[model samples]
Target: MLNADTTDPAVLRELIAGELAAARERTGRLTDCVEDDELVAQHSPLMSPLVWDLAHIGNQEELWLLRNVGGRDPMHPEIDPLYDAFEHPRSERPSLPLLPPKEARGYAHDVRGRVLDLLAASPLEGSPLLDAGFAFGMIVQHEQQHDETMLITHQLRKGPAALTAPAPPDHADRLPAEVLVPAGPFTMGTDTEPWALDNERPAHRVELPAYWLDTAPVSNAAYQVFIADGGYDDPRWWTERGWAHRQQAGLAAPLFWSLDGGQWMRRRFGTLEPVPPREPVLHVSWYEADAYARWAGRRLPTEAEWEKAARHDPATGRSRRFPWGDESPTPAHANLGQQHLQPAPVGSYPAGQSPYGVRQLIGDVWEWTSSDFHGYPGFRVWPYKEYSEVFFGPEYKVLRGGSFAVAPVACRGTFRNWDYPVRRQIFSGFRTARDAGEEA
Candidate 1:
């Protein structure tokens, strides 16, 4: 299916079921790579144990698909408190009575079986949940998100390599320094998108002055220039808060990067290798991305500007669902779905470029924007308030596009991800922008 259009109920059901299976398979692959001990291990204080996530995925599936959709009684109702996210913090999850790996896998598998049977028989005409298979989409997106978080935990775990993939090829090129997004009004969010979350609701218009955005994400080689020139040391390039954080944290370079014997090396999934200069830099904090932009005499694009760059087509005056257009992403279009362990070299996916010739706008790295996370003009709490309502504030900064770790269903043009500005453990990078008429 090209999109979540409700024109054909049978096609919609098939599409949702296929994507749901794919998401479950990805979660299985990630969990299977590590030992059972690793599944129970707490890799980081900020994340729950892998086992918690495993059962949490199953719990959420049972809640949404089984009880809610199929009108079935809860299969494991007593364990609800153990998996309630808001009821427990990440650091405390290891203490909870989480299901063992074997039990967790069986529970999730059982839930999937019932959910699939329901999908095969359920009517899809009424209620928002069944409208174009929105609930199934939500579950798939949720599971895939946890899969990405699990991948992060793998990165943090201390062990021999548990995951492997071929390296992304060097495809960087001397493209335009910046692509011009003309001054005008363009549709911002989506009202018609069947599965759009609350934060991206009620598609509206945003007027932006002309600006120039980097044709591709900032690369490791480019970031190295910042480090060599003392970008971290210079207070002028950093905001007062950022400088203070830098001083307190003693940050010298992007997380996982170090200069050894005059060559830059990085630890990736328990393996150290020379930094791939052409690849988009990953695991940098929003503060780091912001400081890099300042050092280079540019600024991080606003969330609106980033969206316009990715989705707006001036010729048609419409917003597409992706940088490459309304078509769903394919391997040829992006390095998504954890198919590759690392980002493709900047400018690798020419086919994925936006209409404005901006490349790598869909995947490779989650691109940080200058905007704070907030609700749209006419936003309303939907499905659940915790999904987005609790996050509408300046406490978090928004990241756009998606990373190689993100799944296609969860990485659409309107999808939004947010984190604290100091977070660097995530798969993130940035591209700088400037006012169209500003001096270079």
Candidate 2:
């Protein structure tokens, strides 16, 4: 949402300040909803204790904006190693000496207060980190990403439902099952986005063959059919690696799902309910997505293909920053920013559809693509390489679009998310794509 168009420093200050405030507000809500003991406890080995994230966000802000950019000394330098993500894995974090919930909150708030003061005095230009308020924007994004991580911790926590929101609106009309995306060249990455991280840089052109993409993300009803057809048992529907993982992990269905009284039920945030027939399937691993696509005689879209479907507007021969256009997301455009606890129905968010009439391309659940997590041509490390560079390899698969847990500041057409192929604890889903043939 932080565009490169702002030249007025005062307005830029206000914009950056507002986004930072919004992120902190959400962070506060997610942490404050639970008690101190809950914040300190690691609900799952896959996630860090919520308290670590609370103070870490502040530590990163202190390291970057306050010290690196603002020339201020670290407020709590002795605890830096404890909060460094790379220094300690999520599973081992709880054993480290961590700040308590109250102290973490105070540290984060104090860091924020100082950062805002720095924002007011800085020129916000003339340097790569300060130009377009990129550093501040990055910190805001970093915090929001942590906020999403904390929300996932909330989901992983065992308790009564601690979160609630109104359901997404229904789309009155049914949508077609597929939309045709013509084969052509489209820009694959962004060189101009103010806050776009290093990986989505050095804009380059990519050519893709014509393909038919699902009009909406694969729905629970459709995925149920796959499960019913013994999709998980059919080795033919899975790649060798996928089959191996499926068997090794005993993956019978999406995470949080169970069968009860012949009804498909799932635990959401702590409440068990029948799987919503029309919502996009959630918490599926990339391999499972691939297997499901194979079961349906289709395939997961390539990263380029997914981007084209979400961004390219052939009529104008240009790409938009989001499926709906270059504007920041609104509640009506997509189910983003924790606005809803789960995905909207498949046919919903008509306004959020891409030019090709592809719906839910930006949010609801991150759609897995059949692509490796490698950088594009001319990709260069910025600020630091550890954020993305260390993860570049076939060991990880890429996921496109944001999820309902995503903050709008961290979600955009060019945004890239990657996770290990077998990991499904994260909110993830997929829509199938097929090559065009005589059916076209």
Candidate 3:
């Protein structure tokens, strides 16, 4: 995590150098196979042109971190007019005069070299320049995000790469739904130990009555039961808003699923295969999850309740960095990093369960909560204004944990993410919760 102490020039140099190397390695692999023309094509709404994405990422380093903190000019001054993502919306991206792929690659390399040199010359001790560590971290994270986008885009435009490997199947069996969570007061939110997002601020107390959360996210097999029971056709299962959205879109099942031979098959990337019944159902919208919960006689937990169960310790204000503990994410702990590039069986990560034994709470797929997206008691906006404020309306719903594609750095227990209720293209699923009085 980038913090005040991380601003030390030595630390900054080493960190930035390592990140620069990683960025180059990933981008180099992309440019090797993807042609310049292909780099600029709009593969999908979720992805950006490779050329524009690469240039914008490099330019951001100069504009936000380097120029803002170090007082340096952008590598190509002309790029600021065209490639600023904050200034240019996705719809307007294709019209921009994006740099040629070769030129953009050279520019990125040059910017890294210049920034590294500046870092080397700067004082290591007590330098105010460290204030830019957030910006630098953001840049590194941005590049990593692009790396995933490149992977998805490549799969979309071409096919699954020869080198890419599917995520190993998780063979764990689902625990019964009768698992009980004891009634207790659990302190929720970040305790100000270190860097935390604004939404996780003003560490608060919450009391959760004894209740039951599903031992795992709803599996495809369970959802298939809903499908077989004609759950989608029943307006009773859906909220008024959900029913309207379903009718408008003609949604019959999870976005990636289709019926063939009276059996379910799911589209993974561009390839269609039999639905893995044991796997956690991915690409389900909050609306869909809500409907499933309604049909299953349950509801999504509030954000406070979810955090209370996952991170908070009522006695000491101690919370796990992830669901399991303070240790960072590992491949065995969660299905992230495109390791399988798909959802795994819900109970695969019993070791990563929360203190109350709620399983798969960290990753595999982001779990939806009933909470609306809003600022906490004393929420203050970070440098990026649009990050939270833009999605405060009902358009977005709260989601926890990380998904298969979410970066490790961005997947902390306290990190909050949101998406539209109707959008289900990403890796998302849900676990059901019931009122304390309700039977499991």
Best candidate per TM-score, number? 2
Residue 438 local lDDT, model 2 = 31
Error of 1 at 266 (Å): 0.4
Model 3, residue pairs in steric clash: 167-340
Q: What does candidate 2's lDDT look like per residue over 11-128, in tens digits?
A: 9999999999999999988988888999999999999999999999999999999999999977888999999999999999999999998889999899999999999999999899
lDDT of each: 0.90, 0.92, 0.73
Once fitted onto the true fold, the runs of candidate 1 whose alpha carbons sit more than 4 angstroms away are 1-6, 169-171
Which pairs of residues clash in candidate 2, taking residues 3 or more apart in a chain or in different chains?
none
Over all chains combined, what TM-score does candidate 2 have? 0.98
C-alpha lDDT of residue 268 in model 3: 76
**How do the residues 42-150 of candidate 3 rate in per-residue lDDT, one tens digit apiece?**
7776667878878877787777656876787655687687876668776678778888888888888778777777666655334333444445555666676677667
Better candidate number, 1 or 3, judged by lDDT: 1
Can you tell me which runs of candidate 3 are displaced by over 4 Å?
1-20, 23-33, 119-132, 149-163, 169-174, 191-195, 314-317
Worst 10 residues of 1 by lDDT: 1-10
Measured with C-alpha atoms, the lDDT of residue 167 in candidate 3 is 67
